[model samples]
Target: MASLPEGALMQRAAAGLAYAVIGHLRGRGLGGVYGKRVVLLVGSGDNGGDALYAGAILARRGVQVEAWLLADRAHSGGVAALRAAGGGVVKLSEGYRSLSGSQPSVVVDGIVGIGGKPGLRPDAEEALAMLAGVPVVSVDTPSGVCVDTGEIDGAHVTADLTVTFGSHKPCHLLDPAASACGTVQLVDIGLRLPKPVIESLEAADVADLVPRPAPDGHKYTRGVVGLRVGSATYPGAALLAVSGANTGLAGMVRYVGTASEWVKRHNPEVVGDGQAQAWVVGSGSADGANSALAFARASGVPLVIDADSLRALNGPLGVPAILTPHAGELAALIREDRGDVEARPLHYARLAAKRFDAVVLLKGRRTTIASPDPDTPVRVNTTGTSWLATAGSGDVLGGLIGSLLAAGLAPIDAASAGAWLHGTAATLASAGGPVTASGVAAAIPAVIRSLPAVSS
Candidate 1:
């Protein structure tokens, strides 16, 4: 929750960059910039000004600095300072040849900032092609990435290191563009932007949000989670989901399915069928529509709709609920409700949340959680690894969230906290290798323990 005033934040960012550059040089065993060569690709915005001003600092330190202006308009004061500090400027043109043979030690990309358009300008593209293979550092965000949407249109610069001001933007956390951003370094710039349009949950943040057991708390007080999943054909789903809920987060788990034998075999503690505070419905229960619908009408518990259950829904689901859908499922939902919803995830998530009057957790590389009210801030989960894409993982996630909901966390908090824990557990279990659904479930306790302490 730490923040800084707008202008002061920018200055701090510049200072951080100065220190980083100095450190990089020192680590390379270079005495100083007295004889090193640096090239800067300058644009027309504050991004250019940042690089220009930083260049002035390097110029004073004896680095031979050259600024290649890509736009007719440039940062006036920054250019003046660089020139006064003995830096030279040149208008970028086709006359420049390949720098592959004599590449500068470093290149600064200042083409676009946060206000950049979706694609690069013509001249910017040509300049980048000319400087191919040069080690470059991007300011703010990589030029040409969809700053607000995290979408990459056409092409964008791939930086060796990105010096971002303030906190990370969506593009730095989401994929495609995220992959393009190499080692990101945050610079404290003094800008106080509004609450972020998106946010990544950190360990400390999760620690504060997760609930703890009290001395007086009992199994019933902790709350019961009803699970309506699995079938004769795919009983494994029931076991996996139940295993995921066994992390001591839920007081009791109740099973309702034809796969009761399998569920009991795996988790004998589960009740045969009973009332519950929350329900995890559908995971490998393809033919369980009848039972699911019956449970839906009979159970007053908050529900998590997933996999087959999402497809089985017929009318307005009459209860507090959360829908967990990936791109394909979301696309299908959009087709059923709104035509172009999937094209814009934020819009679709908000719309779905409102239409269903329930919390919606849209699963993806960067999971997004939205509430029924548009004004409420959306939560983005950032703790995942690609290993989470394994089969049966979604079922585990459903049970974990259902457990939190049963434990009395609000729908939004339950979904978001469950997602954060699921992702963190996946990362810990994977250890940079392939992991099974059971591994992720097993790691939940460790992840919970790693969270910062909070009194019940």
Candidate 2:
């Protein structure tokens, strides 16, 4: 901002926001922006300035725009511009009734920005309540959210679409607060940035991270993944895990456990236990989780630990490992409350990763993969549907990660890439309907096939 001409950045932001609002108006089939009602909740921050300027542009394009000033003062230039463009500006006390006849087509939330705190004031809360049920387009971020921590303290705006500038705030990728930001639209305003606080795997990133077979590769040459998962009590776990590993990501999958008979019966391609490039243990090993975990540790190969085996970790394993745990399981491992883990997922995930000296993949609505090194950015996955909450789904994910580990990706890469694939496969299999564990596994090949063909 120091290098650029005064207000140049703001103009760029206003232009992008105006375009986005126009695009949204067109999408709503609201007769092409003319005579449509747009309400702007203007605050004291620059976010309100952006909204006011955007409202000016909308007003010039035949939109009936009104700015509801939520603060004692707002941007003088922005206010003047809106007034010049024939837009109405009123105080928060004027209320929603001030909007000329009929409900507003949309509300632009400029109540707060990146510099604000997490909660709304009583008047802001009252203003939000009055405009409840209206679709909101938040500028920069949905007001009243922790931009850096992704934490929500009290009343905050839940926007239908959030227009962010340059880069995504942590709230755009992290959960709880992320859920409030329905659809994040990033607008580049030509600012160079440093490293991000968090990262997420796109399809191209996953494709690059996932290993592909060499031209001369055979079964062993490609990679072999072994699974010591499931027991007589939970044989289905073995089958599901094998199903995920056998999706052609790895050259072969071998099963070594009490459920070998059932696993072989269901997945005939799975061979009996032998040496493997990587080992996946736990899942539903039940009483045998300890032995399975110890055996995998002794193998000296990378390991993917999940389910009943998570309880076996008393301290850091003296080898490379990816620990898969849900909120409850993670809480047990870290000795924290489940609610606390859920609320501060990034913190807990990194803590567990450092504590165990391994990559920790904490599964949830938004799965987070953290490396033991603090410098490494936490990879957050934003794919999949709520239908993936079905039983045995996590088993399949553990197997997928193990397969990637066997295929020669680093533990962190394998964990994150596997999560991306697992979530994408679940979304593909579900297609907005219910999906079983086997169904998600079955969709893995199709998902891999769908990835853009990148040079190896």
Best by TM-score: 2
Those runs of model 1 whose alpha carbons end farther than 4 Å from true positions after fitting are 1-10, 21-36, 61-64, 98-101, 314-316, 336-343
Cα TM-score of candidate 1: 0.89
Per-model TM against the reference:
0.89, 0.97
Question: Native-vs-model 2 lDDT?
Answer: 0.91
Cα lDDT tens digits, model 1, 1-456, are 254454444445556665666556665686776777778899998888888888888888888878899888898877988899999877886226434445677788889999998789888888888878767788888898887776677878988888898788878866557767777788765556778767777877778777677789999999898888888887888888888877889899988888888778878898877788988887888888557856765777788888887776544577889989876787686565433443356666776788778898988777878898667778878778998999889989999998999998988989999999999999999999999999999999999988887654
lDDT against the true structure, per candidate, is 0.80, 0.91
Model 2 alpha-carbon miss at residue 161, Å: 0.9
Show how many residue pairs clash in every candidate, following the order shown: 8, 0
Clashing pairs in 1: 5-190, 6-190, 6-191, 8-190, 9-189, 9-190, 10-189, 10-190
Per-candidate alpha-carbon RMSD to the true structure: 3.4, 1.5
